[model samples]
Target: MASDSPVYLLLGATGGIGSEVAHRLADDGAQLVLGARSEDDLDDLAAATGGDAMPLDATEFEQVQAAVSHATDTYGGLDGVVNFVGSVLLKPAHLTSIDEYRTQIEKNLDTAFNTVKAAGRPMMRSGGSIVLMASAVSRTGLKNHEAIAAAKGGVTGLMRAAAATYSGRGIRVNAVAPGLIGGGENFASQMSEQILSSEAGRKQSEKMHALGRVGTPEDVAPAVTWLLDPETDWVTGQVIGVDGGLGTVRPG
Candidate 1:
């Protein structure tokens, strides 16, 4: 990337949606700092996209700091960030354990907090953008999505508040609330045999979207990339949904 080219820090680079966003930004000739816990996945993605890979554990504060520091050094300054670290626990609210709730909160909220704090450091230099991964569940209710929904709600709130606080300093904060993005091992891992096997469950999930199909990572990737682009200079402090009109009628 040239001195004038935008630099983007992409967290959760191993996941389906994150990888797509990284590729999208790279395609637009943006310099990328890809962060994920899986070194091999990060290496492969970075190599394929001509970006640098940073093995970062989002939960580890120092690790995140180090990765962002490396990105700032390599890119000369930060221009944008896409945080995609999130986890989901699928269980009825009554059956969900406290530990399971904590896991989702830690994975979604804390990881995002760490990445934003770290990335905010160098982003201040160039007046950058920050895109947080939220969920349609944040704005709507669901059966077994309690933990993730609560955490993502917090994420959306955090992004809005951060946007207000940071905009004066030239950093824009926003969130993408996606529907059921069908790609990524993360989403597949959340799907259960019980849910797939039960006809009612399948129908309920499928019908929630007006589009009659679940979302794909590719479907949500463009929204994430566009929000992080410098082109969206005036857009900030908003939680835009990538769902296919689910939030409008059926709160999927």
Candidate 2:
């Protein structure tokens, strides 16, 4: 980050975790350029956070690049960028269609790729951070998560490689991998919520985490912002699990 009050571009700004991250940044006095698929949601979030809103589909490279440029152009420079863009698919490979898999890849991995490509040169100007959202399933085996797991696994790979590629330039890249975030008002999380629609499913999910509960937007937002913090600039190429130990522990 260039200064105390840096400019940031937040993709998927209307999502549950994304919205929380925006307000957290706003509280820290960071000027924001918010981008999301829905213009209406973007406007509402922008108004609430006092940020400029840009409607965009993150799977589109040009749109994402335009967003980066908008952030730099509007605020003079971009100090950080975060991609909260992702998808949730809970189906075995046998049940997943090609189109479904493609959509999954586009939503999670391609968005991350486009974001890193778009932000590289701009942030390279003075060095900044890029945080991406990954999933615990990418590292830990979770049945029926094949499609999403593969997509997010690619995100993890991108985060590390980009971190290596940009480290000398002082740009940081990292990811927050969460497990079963219980609530969110986004396309992806809504799909994820379906898995918990049943009491049996909900109880099983809660018990899957060693902490005896699922996570929330509040549980995940701060970690994203912390990685974006200039204070933690030295941290890079890492996947921090905010997963209630689901990715590492099994409850006894």
Candidate 3:
């Protein structure tokens, strides 16, 4: 029997949006296994969320598989999984290096792939939810976003295909595609930070979103949390846009 309290494996749990999801899940009384490359950050999150900390490198299949195993082993079942592992690269195809392109694929696409591949084993038995972070740039044409767009486009495809492949087994797969977010490890450390650093660049980014400003990790957390909730079991194979109308709307 599945435990009344769901068990969730959060890859990249120390990142901006990931930490928010972890806290929300913890508040909802979900059992969590927090995974990330930094053991210290993971330990801190573990203390705050009351979850076990498992140091993880999401790009490696074995490590992701182990995290999945840890959750099931500790909690008796795995109910949901979300991979917040990603990267942001702002460069045109003409200027992007092959190594940089490959790194983007590895960090964003490969990590999400590994999460779907590994989490399938435990969750298939009792049915669960899986969410991967995607980007609005995948669907919209954004300048100098070549490499990351390609990778995130692959994530969009991977989610759709994996959702189809896993739906019958009772596992639901979804991706949340967010827009130009300003705060968090993702935006703070990446080219996004560089863009938001300059007044002209920041306003340009804000103008890109119909909402008239940039976004925060807080804007993204609830969408993921909602998908992970069992109450939304009927929802699957969908790409939810938490992009502040950036992907599909034109600003006035």
Best by TM-score: 2
Writing each residue's lDDT as its tens digit, candidate 1 over 2-61 gives: 356777888888788888888888888888888898888899999988888988888887
Candidate 2 accuracy as TM-score: 0.96
Q: What TM-score would each prediction reach against the true structure?
A: 0.91, 0.96, 0.96
Model 1 whole-model lDDT (C-alpha atoms): 0.81
Where in model 3 is the C-alpha error above 4 Å? Answer: 1-4, 184-191
Candidate 1 accuracy as TM-score = 0.91
lDDT per residue for candidate 3 within 43-143, as digits (tens), equals 99999999989998999999999998888877889999999998888889999999999999999999999999998877889898999988999989988
Candidate 1 vs candidate 3: the TM-score winner is: 3
Clashing pairs in 1: none
Cα-based lDDT at residue 21, candidate 1: 81
Residue-pair clashes per prediction, in order, are: 0, 0, 0
| lDDT, candidate 2, 1-252, per-residue tens | 333468999999898889999999898888999999889989999998889899999999999999998888766789999998887988999999999999999999999999999999989989999999998898899899999999999999999999999999999999999988867566446756777879998899999999998888899988998999989978999999999999999999
Candidate whose lDDT is highest: 2
